[model samples]
Target: MDLHKLYHVHDFHSRNFLDTYFSSKPDTPFSHETLMYPMEKFHNAFSTGDIKGEVLIDISLGPIIHHLYSAQEYFRDIILLKPTDHCIIEVKKWINSRTGAFDWSHASTFVTEMAGKSDQCEEKEIGLRSAITHVVKYDPNQENVTAPIELPQADCLVLWGVLDVISKDLDDFVGNFRRFSKLLKPGRCLMYYGALNGSFFVVGGERFHIVKYNESNLRSILSDEGYVIRHLEVSQRIIESDLIDFDSVLFCTAYKEQKI
Candidate 1:
């Protein structure tokens, strides 16, 4: 079966994913793993000041913007690249503050409190909304993912659970990574956050495929692609849920050393 075809047929539900993984449940192992862990990782990685940049290109798995709350403080402009219109529309809903948008106040509040500015939760959301300047569609199979538009080589590129979802195998993963690298300046940073050893995730009662790879596989791929790993962190799964099967989560920051 063509995985891409399955993807379109199932049609990823942005709201379903958000509610399933990022609900405002306090102290549940699921929330701790999916929500708090990623937020904390982003906050810690960006706080180092090594990832600061003028423009940040975000190619994530869905319309999720919770991870970008910390990044908005460092990057002047953010461009979101989505593979599906469903994801793009969901993003615009939040950005435009339209009706029925996924509520992200809980995420913003968590991020603000982490930074010791609990009073500025609304301010954080506003900053992130202002920073996201573009939400464009992209095809990972294309030589130029955002063809004809000719986006500038960004100072930083952030990938959150995108490669594994789009990649069918190791070769596909390598090719996709190379294509995404073209959007970043040489020696610039790439922040990656993805599930480790994940095979599939359920959304809206439909199962979607994901490439299964371990930390070593990821490290080797990055190295072969001329990326120098600066920081890498792995968190073990704390909750067992039938909605998804993954052993752990991996988050890392690497610099592209050689232009492709």
Candidate 2:
């Protein structure tokens, strides 16, 4: 790895991440886990120079905005949409990563935002003019409707973050996946990353239970939902200190199969 690149990456994390959230006052011992993997991948995509237009619809704050701020030329716009405002650390990540291109001319970018919980895409027509639109929504109750939740028709990449806690039952999760598959045309990719039900997490300063699913269960759910597994990335628990002891996290990308 180039030391210069690494240094910049570290600075982006420290100055932009820790300094903003943890504050530089008491020197809060903050670590980078959630944003590291995604940001590193973003850099990899840029290095290949194969990317064109990119639109990031982040669900877990806005780290994608941070990783590609000045380092990337592909993204024309970075819209900040949130379901809740508790995503302080995530917002900080965006602020730090957006140092460059903050004042760039986005008049022709065709980028915008939504400020509520549910993203009603299927009900509206945002057209297919954009290049990439990343969506992150995991709802079980609103299953198989095929309306309002359909994402924009662009070079789309839908992500399901924290899937384990989105629903009370596995069938609900599977149902949401099924409807999601219907919305996505064939050949597009969707990435789902979260801990299985056995996983633990801290939300609103309180620990709660999450629905767990192992690799086999995940495969079965996807297979039943009309998807073909294209790629898979799995990792052990990232933050397992005195605060939390979750088992692990899984990241998988699947394509909408041609056949139902």
lDDT winner: 1
> Across residues 127-229, which tens digit of lDDT does each residue of candidate 2 receive?
2212113323333345533235554432334343434544445775676456445545566555566665454334233444455578889988888777788
Q: What C-alpha lDDT do the candidate models reach, one value each?
A: 0.87, 0.42
Over the stretch 177-239, how does candidate 1's per-residue lDDT look in tens digits? Answer: 999999999999999999988888888887888888999999999999899999898999988
Clashing pairs in 1: none
Clashes of each: 0, 8
Task: Give me the runs in candidate 1 sitting further than 4 Å from their true place.
Answer: 1-10, 26-29, 258-260
Residue ranges of candidate 2 with Cα displaced over 4 Å: 1-32, 41-140, 143-151
The alpha-carbon lDDT assigned to residue 200 of candidate 1 equals: 84
Model 1 CA lDDT for position 119: 100
TM-score against truth, every candidate: 0.94, 0.55
